[model samples]
Target chain A: MSEAVQLRRRLLLLTPLGVAAAGGVAFLAMLRGMQSGNFDPRGVPSPLVGRRIPDFSLPAQPPDGVGFGSADLLAAGRPVLVNFFASWCVPCVLEAPVLMQLKEAGVPIWGVAYKDQPDAAAQFLRANGDPYARLARDEPGRVAIDFGVYGVPESYFVDRSGIVRWRWAGGLSADTVSQELQPLLRKYA
Target chain B: MRTLLLLLLLAGPAWAVSSPSEMLPDRAQEQRAERIGEQLRCLVCQNQSIEDSEADLARDLRGIVRSRVVAGDSDRQVIAWMQARYGDFVRLDPPFRPLTWLLWSSPVLALAVGAGAVLAGRRRHAAPAPLSDAERARLADLL
Candidate 1:
């Protein structure tokens, strides 16, 4: 073949290989991206972040006999952690101690018992130790939908201005509390 | 008789499961909700759309879609609201955005590259210049 034809043939031969290599690199980058925890499938980012908490008036948990409303979030005059949990959620059971620790540290934690029967939620708190300064019932899960909750054991850190600063889904362990939750709490507080 | 009664009691709540259709107030709204639901991925089920999923979260999403439709939100607005709350992962057919451009286009790109390679190979091996007349004559004589 002529020199130009030979070069054309080589170029054509390498084109697919180059495309494949580029594709492989892209695939690897995606895998690495997922591994870095930016795209965690378990936790979807809430659109409510940096926005005011959705207006809600949920019935308070038993023993308190007082309901929590939107104004309560702002009246605190300090950042508060709102935790969404359910009696049926196993992870919520696991996260109970971490919430208790936050409460012990004087972090005002508001609990939203999502889609749980009042008696069952009360029993759960009785068994696991209530970490909530105030607890509310999210029956029909309307408040959860308003908050854009996907599953149980989710927590949101609302700033003093009633704007949600950070949200974490899934169970909270001691490590996550100290490393992730507390730092944001300190920042907002 | 006692065992049969116990079995009947165990199955008593089986009939209580209600179809999602019952939540909608009208047929048009239900159809609209279903169309939107089919486009939304059920976050709990991961692989199924909200319309096809039996999960509680899917049910809630379906209700939300129906309520939005009834409240006069257009289909596009409802979908946009969901996408905003749930991120791009909530849509089965993800939009062709900067982040998903590769995901949506890579297959077509691969096919084009394959076709190019095959066409180049065919050209490189093109039928031996159609065998010159003299060569054809010789081959016929040899045969």
Candidate 2:
């Protein structure tokens, strides 16, 4: 065969091979994405970020009689951290100490007792060491629904303007508090 | 057999009561809510649509859809509101956008490449050129 014909045949043979290589690359990229947590099953990205906190007014969990409301968030002149917790949730227990530490550091952390009975929620606070500056009862979880809370032990950091700056789902460990919450708090505060 | 029949009849009402009924003010609005709900994915369940999912979030989403439909929001407006609150992941069928271009186009690209390869192979292996008249005559003599 002439050199041109030979080259043409070779190029034709390479076409499918090139496509196969491309397929392999795409497959590898998908695997890498899964490994790097692009679609993390544990958490969904909060759409509340950069938006005003959802409106809610919930009765306070005693011994403090003051209720928690969206107005409180708006009236606050400083940044605030809002935590959603439930007495029935185990992760809430795990994150209680970290919340205490945050309070000790003078972070104005508000608490929402989501879907918990008053007695159970109060007992949980007493047992875990009360860290909330203001605690509210979200008995029907209407407020939690507005906040897009999937489960308990979620936290939101709001800036002075009442916009949610950050949110962390699941439990907060010491490492997460330091690496995630602390930095965001520093920026906003 | 009569006792068993009686028990089944007794249990049937409980089953009917447990199943979700139309919570919207009217049937037409309830249907609109269902159509919208079917398009929205249940964030908690991931795979099931809010209409099909019994998860708490799905129920809440269904309620939101019904309320929006009742409040005179268009279907598109309701969906946009949901997308704003839950991100694009809440939709069962994502809109065609730059980020989803690969997801929407990769299958077409693969099919095109596959068809091209098949056609090229067929052309390369086309039936041997029909025997020339001279060659046929020579083969006849040899036979």
lDDT of 2 by residue, A73-158 (tens): 88988999899998999989999999899899999989999888989999999999899999888887778877878778889999
- The Cα error of candidate 2 at residue A24, in Å, is 9.4
> Any runs in candidate 2 off by more than 4 Å, and if so which?
A1-42, B1-18, B112-143
The C-alpha RMSD in Å for every predicted model, in order, reads 6.6, 5.3
DockQ of 2: 0.47
Lowest-scoring 10 consecutive residues by lDDT in candidate 2 chain A? A34-43
The TM-scores, chain A only, for the candidates as listed are: 0.82, 0.81
TM-score of 2: 0.75
For model 1, the docking class works out as acceptable
Residue-level lDDT of model 1, residues B20-97, one tens digit each, is 334576878777878888899888888988888888988888878888899999999999988877778788998998
- Which candidate should be chosen as best, given lDDT against the real structure? 1
List per-prediction Cα lDDT, in the order shown: 0.85, 0.83
